[model samples]
Target: MTSTSARPRLAAGQTTDKDIASFLAHTEPVDALAQDGYLAGHDGRAIAQQLRRPGLVRALTFSVCHSARPDTDRFYQDDEEEAAQWRRRRTQTIRDHCAVCPVRAACAELALRDEDVHGVRGGLPEEKLALRLATDADRLGKARAADDRVERLRSVRLDAEREVHRVALMHTGGSVPAAKRAENNDEVRTAVQERDAAKKAHRTENGWTVAA
Candidate 1:
């Protein structure tokens, strides 16, 4: 995101022909932006004004914001359950906002191009965007085949880990602390060990040489 201070701030409801022209010059492709109802309720003039204002443009076009929310926390979460809850809430919030946004298509394209983007953008969380890019790249015969393979393995690993957790909870009467202690319990321990083994095997199959 670029600084808005480079251009003079516009007064409330104030827009000049020059500002509109500048916005037009920097505008993304209209046809692409218009697809998928991105511009459903917006007209040319309103969109031009939004584009001219850098601050407003970023706010409306991007998912991350200064406002406090479950999504505002950095992605390096220490708690898996909390992280999953936050991601679900954040994803829904972003999707709802993108539903009527005028620049959603542009946002989505940028997100696909930058797979490392943090936070949600264009209604997709970082992982989802990576999957989308990998899928698209595969369709286009791009060099993202490895990424696609890794992502698939990652998904399997996640599912296996969840299943382990489920088994652990079931063995521990649904108490997380009890579940942790259940590592000595054959059922819970077996589930965890199996998940770990499967994850290691999948990574090895993908040519990952590092120790798990």
Candidate 2:
């Protein structure tokens, strides 16, 4: 069982002076930015300096502090079942903090744009954010990478089907003998089965709706 007490706690109200001070004292701003994949090609010291500005600090999602569970990194790296337990414990803490947070929308938007970012943000987990990212790609004006992946898989399946057909034809005798035809049919059946399985797997991975 997961212990909810391990989650971060936040006091009610606006971004207080105490909140800002506690966040800076307990958390490393640059590390949080780096985890969001926003630190590349940027100097850590410079980012940290910018984060110290009161306005920027107040606007930051992590500035709420309590939304950031200390075990976030560990949570993402653990086995699925263990990670799920951690997520359940952390869920209410995130919800409580985000309910009054000033930057919840911005935080959710950022989470949507970054696929590699893990852990909870704006009351949503990384997995939920990933699904939103995929489903909302067109709405967000991003390229549909999932569509591209499906196209690639379709191509692969077609190639496999073609190869099976080629093998069947290659084994056909001059008179199209029964034994040869039987062998060809078996090979073709196996190939079609393999192709269907691959297509099903691709659809599942990309969350494509299965056709009737």
> How does each model score on lDDT?
0.50, 0.51
Q: Residue 159, candidate 2: how far off, in angstroms?
A: 52
Writing each residue's lDDT as its tens digit, candidate 1 over 19-132 gives: 553343243334333443333233432443223122223433332232223343443344656867776666566655655455554455444444545666555577877777
TM-score of each: 0.31, 0.32
Clashing pairs in 1: none
Q: lDDT value for candidate 2?
A: 0.51
lDDT of 2 at 59: 42
The regions of model 1 sitting more than 4 angstroms off are 1-81, 138-212
Name the lDDT of candidate 1.
0.50
Candidate 2 C-alpha RMSD relative to the actual structure: 19.8
Instruction: Please give the TM-score that candidate 1 achieves against the real structure.
Output: 0.31
- Residue 135, model 1: lDDT of 73
Question: Candidate 2: which stretches are off by over 4 Å?
Answer: 1-58, 61-63, 66-84, 142-212
Model 1 error, position 113 (Å): 1.7
